[model samples]
Target: MRLPPTFYPALHDRVRIALDRAGLDALLLDDPLDVAYLTGFAHFPNERPVAAWVPRDGEVLLLVPDLEREYALDQRAAARLVVYPEFPGERGPFTVLADAVAGAVRRVGHAPSTSTGRVAALAAAFPGVEPVTSDLVGRLRLRKTPEEITLHTEAARIADAMLAEGARLVAAATGPDDLPTETELAGHVTRFGTAMMYAEHDDVVVVPMLTGGLVYGGANSAQPHRLPTADRLRRGEPFMLSLGCAVGGRFVESERTFLLGEPTAEQRRYYQVVREAQETGTEALRPGVRCVDANRTCLDVIRRAGLARFLRHRQGHGIGLGFHEPPWVADGDETVLEPGMVLSSEPGLYVPGHAGYRISDTVLVTAAGPRRLTGYPRDLDDIVIGA
Candidate 1:
């Protein structure tokens, strides 16, 4: 026995159980994250329709492009690797897939990430079999396994290192035209973390680091998700640094609001409010708690500070193989919190045209309660760049 990696053997068992419980004969996994979750078949999904037909009672069959055959075999993630030509003559990928899907099962289930064309092809093959969309796998994935948590913890460690580097870069800026422009700083953070990410690949299956989209100072920092610009660090404004990366297919996020010169009373107030809201939300990440309740817990802090109108988005979302996964932290989501579920506790205040202050961290709901994975400090003194 090779001793399966990334918990694939255990994950497959869960999928099979889900299939039986839901009366599904087979699960046709196509989402890159889902595929990686089930088979550890890591490959970037593109125009090609790569899929894994995991039957309830048999070995997993991975359908891959001829180009990916070698790696798929080397990894030995799938029980049986099925290779499709780059360009099939008359028998295309669809025809081949139909035969695989039609081999045993009748009730087929597809993930949300599945393509319309792939589903259509399946329908064409079995006209009476209507492939239903099941969140069974998604729900199963919501709770992270211990091995998955190990990967997430490593991802958080990488995020913390990169965030520390970003804060240092901001604090070390001597003048406006320093070595790192805002965009360059973003690249530096990503480049540094990516190098480490690949270096850690010896012990794990590392994915590309998803460098948190860095936004520089002043008005740019005020807009959440703003693209980095050539703008230099402003003296009186704050540089909101957000950083994230995936280690071994697990993702983690870290963020901080940094100020160059001393922050004015108003700037300090904004930063304090955002920080308080973040704490309030993080405190609620316990098993049995509702997802929306956690968001409100964070929101209430801002509401009391009378910055409620300034809040632009939900508190956060689940973080794992995907940056944003299920169980969104919002007012409408009623999903209950469970141990092993990982989420981001990020509450922000964005004052359009002036500045945006955001603090985010990956939080894991455990039996003992919430545990903050990203270790970057959120204190004003810790993040303040300039003296």
Candidate 2:
């Protein structure tokens, strides 16, 4: 699921534009994703720092440990290699890193993720060079390229399949006693998704493209970020599953809340409200629409149902290399939605002692309209198990 080779050249061209606009001679990126975004060097991230140095008018430089030289070359990363002996052999990696920037580059821009200590050290190492902190790469990543969208579409398909498998597992059970525990259910769905990704795409990278999620049953579902437990599913309670997958560093999310059996009237009403909210939010995604406005439109549905107090979070946020990126669909953010921006449509309702209801799908803002990348069914009947 690697991006087309041509994608890197175009991406660097855009980065060069950003650098010139910022009045920077070059940019230093240390965040793992930012580094991978610019250079396609997807090594396992750890305490050992990996950085990408992109000069406005020259080739990109990937600074890594000596141990990773072969790995970076094997990946055919799109940059010149700048290898340091080890983390702290005789001199620290940062000091060795100064060799790349010293004398040759001045007025260098560092990513926002660069630690204050590292920034101070880099500054001290290169007294003549000015280190400016910028969001040059982060801003560029907000919009997906056509090639990125293709990978996102594939990832979304795998996510939808995971949800389908999870629903099947629930449906196979005749009653609460027959239901799998929360841990078992999540494990099964994730394992199935991982297997499917490998089987479906020869280009998928195992180290970087792992797919997984967790399930929350009954009252546990009320919290948006709870871990799956050993508890079994309860009849007449809500079950929530949120699954995400990545292909070639592109990502998407698909989620749903299901009723274990016949739902009570209150449960059905809550479910309907949230489902309507998600659909409304998805539809509101379009060119020139403000993110905050889309968020407000989604919240209106819950407010109309007199469940405004139950709202737990914003409509959603942008999705790409990072699971949660900027251009947030929340009150404070006013970023205008543009064509090629990919976001999640997740408007949820949480009642502390009862349950939480949410349906999230990856949506692409396009000239025609908002297109859903994850094609899983969201209707009440489609999600109700053993009904």
Candidate 3:
């Protein structure tokens, strides 16, 4: 799907304003998403590194490897395209990259010097050129535009539908009868997530977390993937699943915990605490509220519930093109909650032997408090799979 032409102009304007503020003549973007944001061209950065050099007042120039020249041209990503072909034994890709940078910027300002080593290499090419590492571009990206919010809302809808269907899949399965092993369950969840993304017209679906049972629990759960096992779905076992997918380069995250059967008193208590904490966090999301304040709301609830130590990670993070971004809902983040900022409010309590519960949802900061994008039941009663 092609993004609106105004999107690139708006992005260029933001960069130009930021550059003027920082006294920069040009901003060189080597990050794929950053490039795509400024140039509407989405290509693999690993295979062939591409850079978009946006001048403060002129046209944008896209420099790409010769093999990717046609792809860049097809996208019409830039006013001028500089293609460096691979001569069997000539200078490397850096030569083409350095020339492109020199041609675009008389003097560099607010150029990205991280991510790819090329950022620093380009700086070294010009002896007197000043290389500045300013996050102005990133800061500009923190807030979503109206169009971006629309795509995110659609992504959230897709995620919500998948999680709801996945819940039903778990509820209908009985141990050794209709239930699959942990490995099988993980595969099923991954497949279901991918299918849902395709159904929603998304080209790619990144099925991050799909695991089951305590076999692969430990710190591995923090990572996206855990190997599924053959452990049967016992009557009262707690199953946790977290999934994230992107639509049109915008991302959304959703997590759900299901109980195979009725929960014990202890399980019910823990789940209730987590749910309350999640609610507290979500309630705290509003325009003008500090990011840390929302996190404290959830943290305070967890501490009062006597599960502070088990709260390993931050309350949540900003959700956008990347799964994890800035304006983190943690203790020290002072970024004010502004309208158009979308974030995840996930408060989880994990205990090794007993149980773990996480209630998460995508929230958009709006004029009237925060709008919940993912509509799923958060109550403990709603989490139970089967009787």
- Identify the candidate with maximal TM-score: 2
What lDDT tens digits, residue by residue, belong to model 3 across residues 4-121? 6678787788788878888887877777777766776677656455777787877778877788778777776744786767632265554665665534445675435455466556
Best by lDDT: 2
Candidate 2, which ten residues in sequence have the lowest lDDT sum?
200-209
- Give the winner by TM-score: 2 or 3: 2
Model 2 ranges with Cα > 4 A deviation: 101-103, 207-209
My TM-score estimates for the predictions, one after another, are 0.94, 0.97, 0.87
lDDT of 1 at 124: 75
Query: Each model's RMSD to truth, in Å?
Result: 2.3, 1.5, 3.6
- lDDT measured at residue 250 in model 2 versus the true structure, 0 to 100: 82
Per-residue CA lDDT of model 1 for 57-135, tens digit only, reads 8888788888988978776665577777875436667567666653556788998867787788777766677798887
What TM-score does prediction 2 earn? 0.97
Tell me the tens digit of each residue's lDDT in model 2 across 1-387: 998889898999999998998899988888988988988888788777788988889788888998999988887898889898877577767677677653476798998889997788777766678999999888888888999999899999999999999989889987658898999999999899899988877866544647887699889999999999999988889999899998888889999999988889999999999999998889999998999999999899999999999988999999998788987998889999998999999999999999999899999999998999998999999889887
Q: Which runs in model 3 stand beyond 4 Å of their true positions?
A: 73-79, 86-89, 92-94, 97-106, 110-116, 200-232
